[model samples]
Target: MMENVVIRTVSRLAVPFIQIFALYVIVHGASGAGGGFQGGVVFAASFILMIIAFGTANVRRRIDNRGIMWLSVIGITIYAGIGFLALLMAGNFLEYAAIEAVLGIPHLHGILIDLVEAGIGIAVMAAMVSIIYDISGNGEESS
Candidate 1:
């Protein structure tokens, strides 16, 4: 845990901006230079900052092991669900054209891409955080 008041304060202040930028990267991935992996790493970095400043015990209270596992599962489920839905629609796996036909909207492909990206970002973020906890040797309660 961080002991320096100035460091802690600065990390607290910077975390929000870091998160916002990560979101921007995730969202902008559909249109420009950014993607799920980059955004997810950035997002996880914010929590990592918190871990460094506040310690695992404090952060774990806010987000436990179960919570992290669920988030990762949910994210991958979303991604796979979309693909399966497309397949059920008689299209090849992950074929956005199938979704576009059903939705009948402009740029449906882009929308689907964005959704998948979001899912990937969520999964990666949770997984990375979980890894950090494990490496820190504080993921489990000392019973």
Candidate 2:
């Protein structure tokens, strides 16, 4: 584990900013550059930073295997739920137009799209963290 106070302090300070920027990227991705995948990757980087500073044990304590599983499930559920809802509304899978029409809300498509992106971001982040943990071979599973 990195014992350097400077590096640990810097990582601790930068982690939140990195995560916030990741969310920004995910949100802004709808109209311009950046998107779910990028933002998810950025969010995963926060955990990576933590691992680098404190080691896998710390990361595991914060997010165990079960926690990772829940995150993945929740993320996928969010995405699939939105898609199935659109289907229920008699539109194609993931068709936001039908949702917009049914919801009768002005400017809802963008928001729904953002929600989907958020789900994607969450899923990707979880997957990446899991992969990192696995690759690191950080002893046995915590849970």
lDDT of 1 at 58: 82
After superposing candidate 1, which stretches have Cα over 4 Å from the reference? 138-143
Superposing every Cα of model 1 onto the true structure, what RMSD results? 1.8
lDDT of 1 by residue, 25-139 (tens): 9999988999988999999999999998888888889988889999999999989999998998889999999988987897888888999999999999999999888887543
| Local accuracy by lDDT, each model | 0.90, 0.91
The per-residue C-alpha lDDT of model 2 at residue 113 equals 95
Model 1 C-alpha lDDT versus the unseen true structure: 0.90
- Estimate the TM-score of every prediction: 0.92, 0.94
> What's the lDDT for residue 57 in model 1?
83
Candidate whose lDDT is highest = 2
For model 2, residues 45-83, the per-residue Cα lDDT tens digits are 999999988888888888888899899899899999999
What value of lDDT does candidate 2 attain over all alpha carbons? 0.91
